[model samples]
Target: MTEQRFSRRRLIAVSGAALAVPAVARAQDVPAAAPLHRRNTMSFVPQNWQDHFDGLGIAAIVADTTSRALHFWSGDGETYKVYPTSVPRTDELTKRGYTEIVRKRVGPDWTPTPNMLKEDPTLEYMPPGPGNPLGTHAMYLSWPAYLIHGTHDTRKIGRQSSSGCIGLYNHMVEELFAMAPVGTQVRII
Candidate 1:
């Protein structure tokens, strides 16, 4: 285990329910006494540790889709990378039949249907076969069948092809594997 400065507060709030939008935390420079005003339909709430972990920490996520680019953000927005693959949402995964996802290191989950995924520190890949999709590295989110991992099918990279998991190139996933910790927040845009 590594030392992490994560907030127990956010963990507590999430324990109550999985789907609620966890509060977005604000910067320390902002005053707690002063309330932030919203100018649009989307009201701005204070971002929590998780929010800070996103744009300003070791976390990463698939921010969006492009015709060809599979995007990811890591290292306080300093590391930007893209791969070729389609990411599946909980709804889509549920449609396919999986409803529970468990991030091994993270308890419970946030998706409507849980999809269990886990990192094999032992370098375990599913199906126990050659060229398995799990690749050399992985970030196994809760969806039992899904994961953020490398791809042997390089041609499928940058396309919406996976059932509900995020795909990356072999080298890219390996790099990401080295950077993200077990607790790093992964926001699939």
Candidate 2:
């Protein structure tokens, strides 16, 4: 596919506008910057993922349609997923079971990539395969390129290992697909 370049100024404007195009309350997953010393390790295990899932206080699942299931749930600093979905937080509230109001659109040209990818170029722009943290699936949050998805590596699932993106297992993500609609409520704990 042909690539289009969005000027930084334009990107900033567009991102800002994107915030308004989709109406929503502030996302729950946004967290204060962590201490530079590191609070905990980042992992992509089912147990950790589950803990994060349950942490959202069971309000609504800000589901990550991506293969990586990290953003599958929302929580506090312990498991914060960035760019939370702007859609409704519950199926009971609307006809649409779930919907992502602002999914970060990523093509060949994207700006301000995740910290992990920025720190490690080998990981970013990698082809689909082992070590590709993007995994086989990626359901993006409203934040650009930030997603709740699967991972090629399972060890990094639960912790804050991504560049503001949620990570999960490919198989687990397939299961997540059956759970709801495109507009489902996604509440980051």
Candidate 3:
């Protein structure tokens, strides 16, 4: 057998490639492992407004807890957007069905729900600021204490981390808050 030699650079490249092969193969094992966007949106499902709404009255929003995605459509059907969201932490905390946006607030204060307070008496009222959980904007739902809002904790996005609200990235919520009017129809599923 003839002796073969490898440069130091060549050895490292070969070793690195060899180490990466298994990781790449493991990633491909799940054929459905794909990202819908730049974020951690692995389970996003493309939704049609027609399936959930009777009509796009002014604007419509559908928050899909199962997919951890929020879908929005404008009244004229000209604007459509999808956003990954943080859903309620448990099915028990989830309130499904239809509701309308009753109000909008910028720099919203966060008051823990009665149940939330009961569970954690340490929780105190929070005024809107950098430390507030409601991020920068909020759109209240017809249902009491329910909102489509933004979270300061970005990790909460793309995960089931909310008490009952649907959460978006602060930037996304700011955008949605601008596009969605107070009367926007909302559905949670």
Candidate 4:
């Protein structure tokens, strides 16, 4: 065989192009108005997530901050659901721990947290409605000052754009609220 050599910069460029091809292809395959639930968007799921799910005998909620996705594994362990989610924008604000659902509400109100108000004093509490940031449902977590809630801004889903909470699409949150009762274990990774 003949000896061959490749430049480092050429290898990096070729590798980047190879990685981008799949993302471009996936984007083209998805319809413009299609909901994320109907799309194949689990590219960010951890390789060993299924192994953890297999060991769980109880229902659980798992959030991967890096992936910006939430997984609901049923008690049966054989069934699971994934939802596109928006997580805290900064690593400092993203928390990882074991907690449980403390409460659940429908058409939840939006009261700006103390930190939020400090950022913008003009912000006011919002009543439950379409315009509310907490769109249709909210699940309070055992951890203080944290929650998993629906968002009115659908464009933010699958992104890192929240203050310190997990945000889901309205319909997906509604479905999740129905399936996840109070006291469900929530593990953030």
Q: Pairing residues by index, what is the TM-score of model 2?
A: 0.41
* Selected candidate, larger lDDT, 3 vs 4: 3
Per-residue alpha-carbon lDDT of candidate 2 for residues 76-137, written as tens digits (9 for 90 to 100): 33433322222222333122123352332112122345654566665535555555555565
lDDT of each: 0.50, 0.44, 0.93, 0.84
Which pairs of residues have clashing backbones in candidate 3?
A: none
Quick one: ranking by lDDT, best first? Answer: 3, 4, 1, 2
Provide the clashing-pair count of each candidate structure: 30, 35, 0, 0
Summarize candidate 1's per-residue lDDT along 1-189 as a digit string, tens digits.
Answer: 998765888777777556443443335556778656534322222223344232434555442333333344555666656544544433454222212222432111223222233322343334523356655666776445456767677766655566566767777777766666665555444
lDDT tens readout by residue for model 4, 1-189: 997789999899999999999999999988879876755543467533454444554568898887788988766667678888989888888888888799999988888889888878999989999889888999999988789999999988888888789999999999999888787788888
Off by over 4 Å in 1: 1-55, 66-70, 75-77, 88-91, 94-129
> Mind giving the per-residue lDDT tens digits that candidate 3 earns over 118-168?
899999999999899999999999999999999899999989899999999
Q: List where candidate 4 sits over 4 angstroms from the true fold.
A: 1-42, 47-58
The candidate, 1 or 3, that scores higher on lDDT is 3
Q: Which candidate wins on lDDT?
A: 3
Cα shift from native, residue 59, model 3 (Å): 0.6
List candidate 3 segments past 4 Å from native.
Answer: 1-17, 20-41
Q: List the candidates' TM-scores in order.
A: 0.46, 0.41, 0.84, 0.73
lDDT of 3: 0.93
Pairwise TM-score winner, candidates 2 and 3: 3
